[model samples]
Target: MDDNRTDKVLLYKGVKTMIFAVLTLFMGPIILSMALSQPENKLYIPLLVVGLLICAFAVFLIFKGIRLIMNSMFKK
Candidate 1:
């Protein structure tokens, strides 16, 4: 017989990561928009770069969260 059970800790971690990712995803666009709205501002370039990095990190976190969740559910 095989023992198959979900790893609660991993699932929780994954859920946490997903939540963070979602927040980052929303923030990225907002930051980018802010940066765009002030093209002449000294902070524009830095904000743009930070926004882009946040967006990329959000994507990475999403994938990582999914993988963690999948592993929690499927791995033995």
Candidate 2:
């Protein structure tokens, strides 16, 4: 019999990563907007940089999560 069962542990990890990525996605835009609204602030540049980095990280996390979920479902 071919046992093609999904790996629950990896699937769970992927779900968790996706959730975190969603939160980061929201946070990045909020931070970027806040920084844009206060261009004169000394922390504006740093906040903008951080926001961009967070946005990039969210994208990475999304890709990673999808890959993990796919692996869990398809890998032996």
Candidate 3:
């Protein structure tokens, strides 16, 4: 790969990783607050489950981005 293309790829992966990390951090508090605020509501369970899934997806995205960056750096 050319230097320009490699730099762009690295930048994209880094940015994507940061975005996923931010989403995970942001969603955690929102999910907790929602669960705590509506303890009596039966819907909270579903909401919590959905929130957990979203967080998990964000984490997966983060790992994927990291893997891409690492592969780019170390590939023979």
Candidate 4:
């Protein structure tokens, strides 16, 4: 196997993770806002919970992506 292949793979994985993280982070708030814009009170709690979960997962993704990127860069 070529030495650079692993580096490329890691880089690609990190980039994909970052992209997904950004989407998750932004979409969560946007969705929550849209949901709250409605006058109906029935779905508030559920939407809030789901939004928070999305945000939390986004954070985890962000951290994992950063870690993967750093590992790739420092790998010998």
Q: Which lDDT tens digits does candidate 2 get at residues 30-59?
A: 999999999999999999999999999999
Tell me how far the alpha carbon of residue 6 in candidate 2 is from the true structure, in angstroms, after superposition: 0.2
Candidate 2: the clashing residue pairs are none
User: Model 3, poorest ten-residue lDDT window?
Assistant: 1-10
What ranges in model 2 sit over 4 Å off? none
Q: Which scores better on TM-score, 1 or 3?
A: 1
Cα lDDT computed for each candidate against the true fold = 0.97, 0.97, 0.75, 0.86
Any idea what lDDT model 3 has? 0.75
TM-score of candidate 4 relative to the true fold: 0.81
Worst 10 residues of 1 by lDDT: 67-76
TM-scores, in order shown?
0.95, 0.95, 0.65, 0.81
**Better candidate by TM-score, 2 or 4:** 2
RMSD for all candidates, in order, please: 0.9, 1.0, 3.3, 3.1
lDDT at position 44, candidate 1: 95
- How many clashes (backbone N, Cα, C below 3 Å) per candidate? 0, 0, 0, 0
Least well predicted 10-residue stretch by lDDT in candidate 4: 1-10
38-66: candidate 3 lDDT, tens digit per residue: 97999888888877877787777777777
